[model samples]
Target: MRLENQIAIVTGSGGAGGIGEAIARRFVSEGAKVVVCDIDEEKAQAVAGALGPNATPWACDVSRSDQVEAMVAGVVPMFGRLDILVNNVGFTVPGFLRDLGDEAWHHVLNGCLSSTFYGIRAALKPMREQKSGSIINISSAAGIGGAPGLGAYGAAKAGVVSLTQTAAVENFKSGVRVNCVLPNAATKSLTAWFDATESGRKTRAAIEAYSRCGSPEEIAAAVLFLASDDSAYVNGTVLPVDGGLSSRVACIDATIE
Candidate 1:
């Protein structure tokens, strides 16, 4: 058990099919007590129940700083100590930059970027006191570059990447390894986006061409590696688990004079 005797909190893990749920299962299987949190109370409880007593469900809107702080405080009382914090909550609003409305832009940013900030801020105090911990922020390939029609989401994820780097540097001497994971996983969110409209389908098809859709388990494995001693030397890195797609750059060069 890589995470034996560790206590982890994973955000946005209440749904039936999502990255959060996968992370919960993976952490539990590796002997970690996980707190599965989501905005939907019922869904959170259901997922926790299915995972057994070791997994507790909590409802929280991470975008709110007070709620986020309280969530961490509550977890410490129940779990004794927090060893890992996984900022897995995220959302996306698909549309061209000009076509995107203000509400949608804020919605995506709050859910994806702001929530990550709140979670990390709340966890930092405890981790710093303990002087040892790991924080994993889930980013996206769109964050590494620019993705048309996903401006809001892409921007938010990019913020997460930058946050990870900054936090890692600040917390380096404290033994708190802050890292980010850019996963290419097949989940409800991605599936719905891919099936939304004709244009969405085409975009998704192009994405699938370079690599087969990765499973949630695959992503869980990466998170586990970051959270464990395997990555003790790794810090402030944005790992792209995109199956080589992000590195696939085409070249057109001339060798003739």
Candidate 2:
């Protein structure tokens, strides 16, 4: 019950077996009231309903800043106080950097990076006034380095990390801890990407470092740590729950002269 009596908002929390849903469940199990938000109204309601009365469903497009702001503004009125916000809304259409169309490029950036900005910005005001809150952002391992076809996704996710750090520094004195998590989980969307296309399957097979996909529960555990007071002294930290794939650099060959 680390989050007993607390109110938390977890975005993109509708998909079955998604990271967002896992996080929402973790929060509720710890005694926090969670708002399960997603682009799809039915999905949002389903997840929330299954979580029981402590969970409420919210439907909105986080890529739209107006919707995001409005949602955040309504939270305090509904729940009385906001304690945590998990920016987990993200999507991407994988393709090569040079071959990507403008629409896809912008789509990836807006959904992944801009959406993160909207959530953090909207949550900051209430958190600042209360002088206590936690904001956990979900980034990706692709952002840490180059990926075969995740150029747009990588770039957008990279921005998320930078934004989290900046927000953390600015809100340090205000008691609102901002942190980011890089997760490599075997969620529905991720698995679909690899299984839906031939190129995707090839890429998945070739990648040895991250061949082992972690469960969504593992990622939820990291988010819980960041959301709770256990990480009170921690801020502006980018934690990797990617099973060390990001740090797996190839062994350089050197000949002794």
Candidate 3:
């Protein structure tokens, strides 16, 4: 197993088939102990429960610095090692900047971008002390270019990419690797949302790289690579598992009107 005896924390791992849960499952299957962290305690427990003993449920609102800090502090003492940290918590509200409300704006910024900051900040101490750790921040293709109705989300995700690179550079001397992933997961909710609206359907149809959307498992595979020794020499990389969405103009909207 690539991650044998490793300890990992995967935030936003509550949803049954979301990318976070898929990552947690992948980590555990590879012989790592994982903390299934999410804001929803019940959902966290549910996912953790299914993953068995190697997965522990952790109720954490990653957007809250206090909660994130506390969670990271508790990991090493409990697991005896902090090997991998996947900052996978993110959500978005769709609206043009002009029409975007304050609450929606802050929520998107805090949840998607600030949450990444909080996780990385808290996890850095332990990873630095250990002298060997991997931190993978989940970014998005939305951050790559113009996302018409997703202004706040795009900005926050863009921050994630910048933050990942800066963290990687800062931690190089400490033997810690920080990377980022732009994953376009074709999870149930996303598929349904796309199917429910003509614009969403058009957006899905615009994907040029593959005939189908990338699965959660596929995204997990990319993340597993960055988290394990396989990526020992790799650092500060922003890998896109978005089926080439970031490459060209897939500017179709998956926004709520």
Give the alpha carbon lDDT tens digit for every residue of 1-257 in model 2: 99999999999999879999999999999999999999999999999999999999999899999999999999888998899999998878878988999999999999999999999999999989999999999999888988787899999999999999999998878989999999974586676777789976875574544457778899999999999999999999999997777767746536599
User: Over all chains combined, what TM-score does candidate 1 have?
Assistant: 0.94
For all predicted structures, in order, the TM-scores are 0.94, 0.93, 0.95
| Candidate 3 colliding pairs | none
- What tens-digit string does per-residue lDDT give for candidate 3 at 31-84? 999999999999999999999999999999999999999998888899998999
Off by over 4 Å in 3: 208-211, 249-257
User: Per-residue CA lDDT of candidate 1, range 66-153, in tens?
Assistant: 9999999999877778999999998788899999999999999999999999988989998998988999999998898887888999
Clash counts for the predictions, in order: 0, 0, 0
- Better model by TM-score: candidate 2 vs candidate 3: 3
TM-score of 2: 0.93
Candidate 2 ranges beyond 4 A from true positions: 192-199, 202-211, 251-257
lDDT of 3 at 157: 93
Question: Which sections of candidate 1 miss by over 4 Å?
Answer: 192-196, 250-257
Q: Specify the poorest-scoring 10-residue window by lDDT in model 3.
A: 246-255
Best-fitting candidate, scored by TM-score: 3
